[model samples]
Target: MGLGKTLQTISLLGYLHEFRGITGPHMVVAPKSTLGNWMKEIRRFCPVLRTVKLLGNQDERKHIREDLLVAGKFDVCVTSFEMAIKEKTALRRFSWRYVIIDEAHRIKNENSLLSKTMRLYHANYRLLITGTPLQMTRLLDILEDYLMFRAYQYCHIDGNTGGEERDAKIEAFNQPGSSKFIFLLSTRVGGLGINLATVDIVILYDSDWNPQVDLQAQHRAHRIGQKKEVQVFCFCTEYPIEEKVIERAYKKLPFDALVIQQGRLAEQKTVNKDVLLQMVRFGAEMVFSSKDNTLTD
Candidate 1:
């Protein structure tokens, strides 16, 4: 998803160094393949910030660990997921300014080795970046605290919000020069009864069970009279219940089914309770397999 996540993160580091005087020990854990790109982007965009790459075989890493990898010596440490796990003890020594994870979906399952290893390091702030929608609902749950700490102006509405209050918030958000930067709402609550043509970007942090519900939510920013191109980002998990739900939802659409002669849709039926139950149970096998190997192959 060449969506500039790398550049944006580099810019943030640059801001901290240039403005805040926080020339820091920020650690970035990414895939082995992207480590070079991360280093390149940082040098290309923010050459002033010193960056050290934590990579190589055992002896090379030992050399880096002894000489180049020290606090106050480098602004950022770029490393891969495999290196993080292997050198967890060495990396954990520093209290980082920020621990940023790229391709964060790799840690969607909390039980994963990479996910658990990432938590062993200490950081004032942790940022996870991924194009995929993985555990975005959990991400949204933490935004309130993060936004409050950052003092960012934002408005929110949920099922509990009254119609008048919701409309007022929308009006405030749509007003030009308004300080509001984010509007948080539940899909069912905000899907149909709102128009946010003024909005240019929509982040679907929560995935709806029904595809239509998510589409309607996207239209809030893409309605008539909208000038800018609406960028809709849907955060969904790869496997497990959410993925299965999305798969079932799309398969339910009549247009997705095979249309024979005379526009006759292929024979299909709504997912039954058993099918729904199976979808819910789809990913539980991993948990069970961890306990008893006989439960799954």
Candidate 2:
């Protein structure tokens, strides 16, 4: 999960600033919880870049805009998803170089107002970053995969009984391809679209367990029409979960699916104290054995 997506975004911004010489204004839309982190990362990586945290009432938003546009004081504007939705009208007033969506999975539900607002914005580049992008749950005896997986049921129709004067109502809405704004780069979302082909690189972090999450995340960059071969960097670790995840990802099993099923299984089962104690004891033994080997002359 700590694969430096934010750092990559900062690097991209730096490239746009130095090589392209196109630094007008940039916006980073992320979760409220992470807006501070984004600001911190920006300050640390690109200290020269001016950043203004946009949050508060209408007047506050207006003030921020004035400070940015009129004074030309800030280079990047960081705002939360809620504020983005509230102040979309004001946000759209300025011409932005790049509009980045961190934790872009918040827009998974295209019907939501947040999604609508994000789609309405005009920016040169749109980047989406997240660790988990799909929601899969079981209800009423069916396995349903929403969004990225391409399985969605909009409505149900009733049949006419014996042709007795009856009219059927129709319900419709745009599918996944409705708004073609988001370009996903994640270890949680899976697959890529046929027409979608603009990702440059996908970095994968190493783990102890089967990396179903990382594999699915890589697909977001490697779908059909991708101009270049997706460069995947797996940062392997010594953690047990990381190791197992990497092994499973190599085996080609959907990481999220395994996590979901296993989560459900754990929820439905009861914990075994003796078995857990034995496993803990085994871990302790391994740790002590390693220490003993290191101490010997």
Candidate 3:
């Protein structure tokens, strides 16, 4: 609850602007509930960097879109996904220094219009964050699916487990010197608020739309009270949808040697129309056919 991710981000933006001399018209797209929080964080952390929340009536918002976004009059701009889509053309024109997304469920489904629209905006760096679990069941890779059956490793947490069953799994995970390897979890189920500091490694079998949820899961083992230095891994397939998901999920991350990734941050776009059609068709069929289909198209 007290996590200061907002402050951390402000620090990064400030560092890039002040120390590196890379002044930016950075952008932050968050859910409406938290948009004000982002603005507040900006004022608290880096007041030196002027900012604006992209809102108001069409005329007022349009004025910012055409004038401020182009002139870089503001250091950073915050808006909701609704605003991003409603005002795409105007927002897309300017090449942004960085684009940060909060409650980033929109990008989870590559076929989703919001996801596709988000990819059109040009930025040197992209950051995606979400507060809840987004659609994780994207189009499945037949080849990857086949490989899963042949694989011998993994511990997955089902969504329906009761308190006792869930606690057992958590206990086993945190017991002294356990030998378990790969761990899998539903984002909504296990990625909310749990501690698993015994394990030294984590693999997000599926990426959640919310970066915060994913962070919560990753910290299961790597958070406070963990004895060993942890290693975290996330998977991104080569398919266009999968690739976009991966790109948004990891773009905000800093490199091992460098504190931040700088230069040539191009926004991702949809691939061939043919591939997109096939995926949408397949995903739609899957959704309609199964009563329990939880996969997001």
Candidate number of the best lDDT: 1
**Number of the predicted model whose TM-score against the real structure is largest:** 1
Model 1, range 92-181, lDDT digits (tens) per residue? Answer: 999999999999989989899988999889999999999897643554556766888999999887666788988899999889899998
C-alpha local distance difference test of each model: 0.80, 0.60, 0.68
User: Candidate 3 residues 1-297, lDDT tens each?
Assistant: 345557768888999988998878888887788888888878887889888888889899878776766564788888888899998877887789999987666677889987888899999899765545454432223223544786733344556557777777777766676544545566666566667777777666677655556777776776678888887766655443655564454433323112232233233343456744564455345434545433332
Worst 10 residues of 3 by lDDT: 253-262
Against the true structure, candidate 3 reaches a TM-score of: 0.46
TM-scores of all candidate predictions against the true structure: 0.52, 0.47, 0.46
Selected candidate, larger lDDT, 1 vs 2: 1
Any runs in candidate 2 off by more than 4 Å, and if so which? 69-72, 135-297
CA RMSD per model (angstroms): 15.7, 14.9, 22.3
Count clashing residue pairs per candidate: 2, 17, 2
Query: What is the number of residue pairs that collide in model 1?
Result: 2
Worst 10 residues of 2 by lDDT: 165-174
What ordering of candidates by TM-score runs from best to worst? 1, 2, 3
Pairs with steric clashes in candidate 3: 130-210, 130-211
Model 3: how far residue 226 lies from native, Å: 31
Model 2 lDDT per residue over 1-297, tens place? 697789989988888788888675898998898888988998999887788899878787777767654437778889998989887777887778889998877787889998889889888778887767342211111222233356443221112112222112110111333332232222222332222345445444323233445545566556565667666555545543554444444443333444566776576585467745564454344334553222111
